[model samples]
Target chain A: MKDDLTDRILVVLSSVLMLTAVYMIFFYAPTERVMGIVQKIFYFHLPLAFMAFLSYFVAFVSGVLYLVKKDIKWDIIGSASVEIGVVFTTLVLITGSLWARPIWNTWWTWDPRLTSSLILWLIYVAYIILRMSVEQAERRATFCAVMAIVGFIDVPIVFLSARLWRTIHPVVIKSKSIDMEPAMISVLAISMAAFLLFWITLIRIRSRVDFMELRIRNLEKIKRGGME
Target chain B: MKNLTYLAAAYGIVWAGLFSYLWYILSKQNVLVGRIKALEGDD
Candidate 1:
């Protein structure tokens, strides 16, 4: 009951934050002098990327914990986090491409940052496929835990690709300065908070669903054994 | 008003993706709830 109440509160808080963020993005933030209206996408795009990275990091940590403790709950957390990470990353890519078309004159480019992000996406897709292929629950969990740990190596590379190499992708946060105005930064921060809350809410719901599935599986196994 | 279409598309895709995923999660939850209830009933 306590957990249910907390979840409800979180859902309400996140929804309110999301609506406020949208309003700030469309109305409160000032328009860019150069990019015009297309620049508005930055409010959503940057925050989605930040949340995606945070989600993957959570999955990576959960994966490590699962390996250390051999707990199915940790595996559930890792799985749920990765699923949410993939969704956010997909949004990041789509919003990015949409932002690019007006500015870069192309739908796709083989730039380092873009390529590394795509690789990150592909790696998680492979992780999901791997989990599906293995029939044994324990074995599947163990394998996925390992894969999550290994695949996390790509995340740093994705983040650093623009810095390490010359790339067309804009580096908003540079060594010396951030390339955004005060109002823009404020809107971005609010949007990030909203998305982060939403991410946590989704992960909680997903992990609960995973727990239910685990319970059902165990119950079915017991029933089969009793019949024998 | 220039580049309005791009802004609209970007926002559209973001909301569409998020809402679709939310719908997917809720639908799956509904199915799982039914199955769990059925299992409990059997027990």
Candidate 2:
């Protein structure tokens, strides 16, 4: 009962904040002098990237914990995190492409940041596929835990690719400070907060499903031939 | 208003993808609920 209330609160809060973020993105933030309307993509693009990285980080931690503790719950966390992480990364890639068409004069580019991010997406996708192929529960969980940890190696590379290489991707955050005005900064902060809540809500939903799946599998084992 | 098509497309796809994923999760939940009910009925 308590958990359901918390989930409802999170769902409502996330929806409200997301609507606010949308309003602020389209109305509150000032248009860039050069990029014009297309610069609005930055509002969501940045947050999507942040969430992707955060999701994978959670998956990585879950992997480590699962390996250390051999807990199915930790494996479930890693699996759920990776699934959402892929969704966010897909949005990141597509939105980045959309923004690049007008800004960079191309739909896609082989730049360092773009390439590394694509690699990161592909790795997680393979993780999901590989997990599906393994039949045994413990073996599947162990395989996923290992892949989640190893695949996370691409995350840091994606993060630093823009800074390390000469790329068209704009580095919004420098070591000292941000490059935008106060209005834009506020919008970004709101969007980030909204996305954080969005991530939490989705993660909870996915975790519940994961738990349900485990229950169903146990019930199936009983249905096969075992005593009730 | 420049590049408005691109802007709209970007936001549109993001929302569509998110809502679709949410719908998928809920549908999966429904399927599991049915399966659980059926299994419990058998026992």
For residue A189, give model 2's deviation from the true position in Å. 0.7
Q: Model 1 chain A: which ten-residue window has the lowest total lDDT? A: A1-10
Count clashing residue pairs per candidate: 0, 0
lDDT of 1 by residue, A1-228 (tens): 575577678878988998999899888999899888888898889889888888888889988999899989999999998999899999989988988888999989999999999999999989999988999988999999989999999989989999999999988988888888999989999988988888888888888889889988988887788789
Regions of model 2 farther than 4 Å from truth? A1-5, A226-228
In terms of DockQ, which candidate is strongest? Answer: 2
Interface RMSD of 2: 0.8
- Give the fraction of reference interface contacts each candidate recovers: 0.71, 0.73
TM-score of chain A for the candidates in order shown = 0.95, 0.96
For candidate 1, the per-residue lDDT at A225 reads 83
